[model samples]
Target: MIGKARGQEGREGAAGVLPAHGMTHYPAAFYHMTHLFYQSGPPLYAGNICTGRSGTAIISLMGETQGRVLLVTSGKELLMEMTPSMSGRGMELVCVPTLKYAADRLAAGDCPTLVVDFGWLPPSERGALLELHKQFPKTQLFTLESVASMAPAVPSPLRRLSWPLPMGFADQVRVIAKPVIILADQVLFSTGAVQNAFQQAGVQAESLEFGAELPDFIRRQSEARAASARTQKPKKGWSLLGGDEEPEQEAAAAIGNLVVAQFTGSAAQAGALDAAVRAVAPEAVCYLVSGVDTQRYAMQSLKEGQPVALPREQAGRIAGIMAESAEGGETRLKQRERERILLLDNFKPALTALSQALIGHGYEVTSSMDGAEALRLTTKGSFHLAVVGTAITMAELSGAELAQKMRERDPDMRIIFMVDQYPLKAALQGVSQVVELGLDDAILKPVEASRLIFSVEKALERRFLLLENARLLKETQEQKNQLELVNGFQKKFFATVAHDVKSPLTAILGYAEVLTGKLKAMPSEGRYAANIQTSAKTLNVLISDLVDLAAMESGKLRVEIGTLNLLAVMNDVYERVKIAATNRKLNMTLEVPPVLPPLAGDDARVGQVVQNLCTNAIQYTKEGGKITIKAELKPDRVEVSVIDTGIGISKEDLPRVWERFFQTKEAMGMRKAGFGLGLKIAREIVQRHGGEMGIESELGVGSRFFFHIPLNGPPPTEGAAGAAPAAAPKPAPPSGLPPAPRPPQQPQPPPQNPHLPPQPPQRK
Candidate 1:
């Protein structure tokens, strides 16, 4: 019974014992019991319990975790001291002495946590640490310092932990559960502590200690996976088309497990390892561990952040935190999905680095190393924004010059400039230049990825706003054009209706006049006939005004130019309106120079203009008021005025007298028979004859309405002679009025060809 109890105690000890530094120094009895457990018992490690030594049925216990922690330090003594504490808490420690080795490890897969001992890192490598997060964004970075030199006022991404780790401080380390293949020096694997720890954590472990053998091993694995995939038969119904021949297949290489390697001191050998892994098994996860002497290096600089410390006792808690963080973690900077960016630079290294940084942040980036090539790309492709390097040296175009050319192609394209710090004059001018060139922003040299991203987002937002505004403006213009088109169509419809009504109206007026003559013997019947004739004539005048207004609106009013006798036109107008004036109890007179200069004008249209002015004067003048029609010859034109003692227009209403359908309150109360289009139509006719009309009036006294006819007549296009002038028809006398006698005139000259220009007046 005593021996059996002792055996049970040994088994329990082996099962619960933590793997740590100097773990090889166990009692002989403990080793014997461990051997026994390994040979014939339930698998002690987390690796394949069913497949045993073959490790074929490997299952990852930590597959839920996405990435691992990378420890970078050159302090061998510190590492040796921390190894035991880390191992005691079941944490996995992989240290790389240099930044290059750290990069290799991170590039292999995702890294959620990074711990760097800044105090022990070489001075030459300190600056590179500032940009480490850009290259590996998934990492949650921390730095160890010997002194608190950085100000707490400035915020930084790095979590700073003081050196000479505190007694109770702790840090989290990621656990690897998948099968691991280690490539390192033979001394590292000699003790088998790493293998044992991995096995305990359910991670299958193997080793190839020589760096020279990695390429061959990778090549063999790739060939074996390819052969296995190719040998497999296709499943039934794999091809959409039924055929005897096999369908084309893509041979997918199998990535079996993770790899942990320690590279040699030679950089070339390390580069070879990276190339071999990428070429043969691109999907394989790898960790490159390197070592250096901390005694030779010194810390020369510090970075900004809040100071913290990790304690040994709380190591287990830190591990749990790391596991939680890695499960589903986000980077410090937010990702911008699917926004295309054009990056221009002449320096290859800077261009490549920035390109990677932007790509990691979820931006679709197109980079150009030459300015000319960048311009070509910009012309061919559409981009939301462009980041230009102002100090370009490789191509014919500088950064600003290239941006200007791009702006010419796309006026609304958003641009940001990356300017150098040297040349103080240029740097100082950058702000004004940004505003002048309409650039979005200008960032100094060595711009941080975060700041650049913020600027880019702002620029893109502005671009979106501008595009939206332009779209709205275009829509408004389209609506305005549509409204104008509708108005034009309505005017054309009015003209057509007015023209159609004139033919029927003329017949009504002619029949009414005849009826009046026939019913002269009966007083009552004659009165009715006269009323019908008067109403028809008023309707005819309104229709004529409507037609003229529509024609003027549509730019179709016609005036046939000819040599005019001013005396004949004035006499015609006087004869037509004098009887109406006498009936209204207003005295009308006409005064003109008998031998006035021959004017180039349309005789009938000019007669109509004079007649309209006289009619308005007669209608608006009070009883016993005087109306005088006067004509005077000026140096370049003839002035015709109608002076009346009438209810005149107010100053406020004078300017609006020529507007169609506009009427004053006094005019509406005095007469509701007209549509207020007469003055507007008359003014248009006078203008078409190369003339202008205006009115001078006072509210209570009198009004003088006048117009000017240029001696040259209307422009050639407006008043070109199309046909001979039609003779003016005589009006029937009104009821109970004598016939208007014609004024005697001198013998008229022979008519000239209608198409010929007006001849000079003959001096008699």
Candidate 2:
């Protein structure tokens, strides 16, 4: 009765069958294995033991392999024979099928060569080679025959590791012994590596380059034999899953949006994949197949017809983005419209600050509960990036699935998938990106304002690069149309110039002939010559306006902006064009309100708008009709209008009245010929001043051409206007000369709106 081993009651079983180079067969009902199993006299273990090796370093970690080992298998048959045959070779024996329960004891300065019977478990529990390494450090592995039926399926994670020792002091060295396992493809990998992925999972994976076959279950899936390609599916219960009746549905397959599938159970690994997807394509939505149910659910989604798929090219997008580095360029390519980013998270505190941080970096931000409203938003497609956390519990599409669906509509839509656990191995089936969601990347739940800002800014820097490059390319193509407009206008300008110059030249010569002969005897003939001179002057003004417009189009209009009194500026304009109105026999009135404010702008440009309106009113006003000039001050702006009871503009001509070289048919015939550049120039000047210019008219009635100029600029400070009218008018420069500044040409008085109560029409 070889009962040498002791339990709590100090009892042992007879041990038997032992191998010289293999396990010393010792069995006890309560057997426990440790390097130095102090029992049956000192310690016992026999076999060639070595230290951790080079490259294959597990051996070096077991500092003393030449120590006794307590060995036990659960089966009592093996223990019976080993007890009598044990003698002094076997130390203490205890039944243990797995190494996890004994990790602490193994680390208790004892030999950690574990002969585990893992055959009882299915491959799914095992995950990968590294799982064991991660769970049980410094423990060498040996296998038992028939372990398949001996161990439980999934190890209970809640079970605490047992540490049974009398007194202890472990060595200073921390053993990170990494084992070497040659993959089926002959690819050798260090079991101790931090990133050996699927190979460590029970997916029967080889090296990345050597993977060809999927597990029997996946291979058996009823999918068409289409070549492997990127794919993604909506989450379970999402609208794509057949108008989901259930409010809460997670994405069946997170791998639906990846280029390859890797079976991994670590939530960290899943997030890592998600991040990888973003890094590669910044806007790619990564899906995870976290489990069998998820995979099946996703496959069913495919059979039912997907709502949408990746709408844009991913690799092409990334490449284009790389080509157009938005961060590197100081100038942004996008039109200055503010962009908004949405962070859909249910974990409020964890992600709110993060969303706000994104906004701080100049992006508009909108948040949702999760992916519930996410798909709806993406369908409308305005946001640039969607950041989803794994902990959110909103119904419909999960954050991950929403991202995937969004990717279909906007290939460049950036997505960040965060998770709560080590996703299931099955979830990685077709994923390309997997990011472990945690605080590792400075990602905080209830994220720190600064940290949240940094992560999103970094992501946006990348996403914006891609988006801006694409947008700029499109804009460049559109700009081509503008160039076409430029060329076409060049031809048109030349034709107008020829006609204008020729008409004036003929009138000048004919009038010169008449004045030299038939009109020489009568002073009245001088009036006829003056008419010819006026026509000549008009043509000259037209040519000059054309020249100025050409310069503006060429981007060379170099007028400097400065502070000038708007009232004074208007008065100067009225003085300059007052004669033009008089010559047309048009009655004109100026309505100036009391006390107006000063304005900051290019004195010349403001004057141009005033002059153009006044000139236009006078030109179109029928003989004996009246024209009025009015200015008014509002809290934020000053408005000026030139009203005429002349040949009013037709609605057909109103829209194009400001278009360059566009002349009203009346102006082309009845009114004196003039270049179409006046209103165009006025519009440009107003736009530059951040003001507005427009007109209202009715043919045969009259026209009101008005413009509004802000009363504040050039630092935008408050100041009183120099409303005093000019004491004595200085001689004005020739046409095209920017109006001279007149002592902060403040408004002479508050001008009225062109539509203001007319101060009773004036009589001619």
Q: Which model scores highest in TM-score?
A: 1
TM-score, every prediction: 0.39, 0.29
lDDT of 2 by residue, 183-273 (tens): 1111111111112232233222223222222222222221312222223344554576568544222222212211223333333344344
Q: What are the per-residue Cα lDDT tens digits for candidate 1 across 1-764?
A: 00111232222223323222211232223111111123346533221101111111111121232334456655444444443334333344455555665665566663455666755665446447656765765555555544321222112222222221222221101242222234432222322333444444554444555656766777776676678677767666635366555533433444445443433434334434555665555544333321111110101010112112232223233344444333432331112224668888767667766765665565556777667766776753377789998887435665677788888887877999998887888886765679889999999988888889899989989988897899999999999999899988878777887989999999999999999999999999999999999999999888988887787776666667778876778877888898999998988888876555556787888887888888788878889999999988765667899999989999999989988788888777777488888888888777766567878899778799988776544545523344222333322211122223434444556343232455677888
Assess each prediction's global lDDT (C-alpha) against the native. 0.59, 0.47
Pairs that collide in candidate 1 are 46-202, 47-202, 168-311, 169-310, 169-311, 170-310, 170-311, 172-318
Which residue runs does candidate 2 get wrong by more than 4 Å? 1-532, 579-585, 650-653, 666-669, 714-764
Candidate 2 CA-lDDT value? 0.47
- After superposition, the stretches of candidate 1 with alpha carbons farther than 4 Å from their true spots are 1-418, 422-476, 550-558, 582-587, 621-626, 650-655, 664-666, 711-764
lDDT of 2 at 178: 14
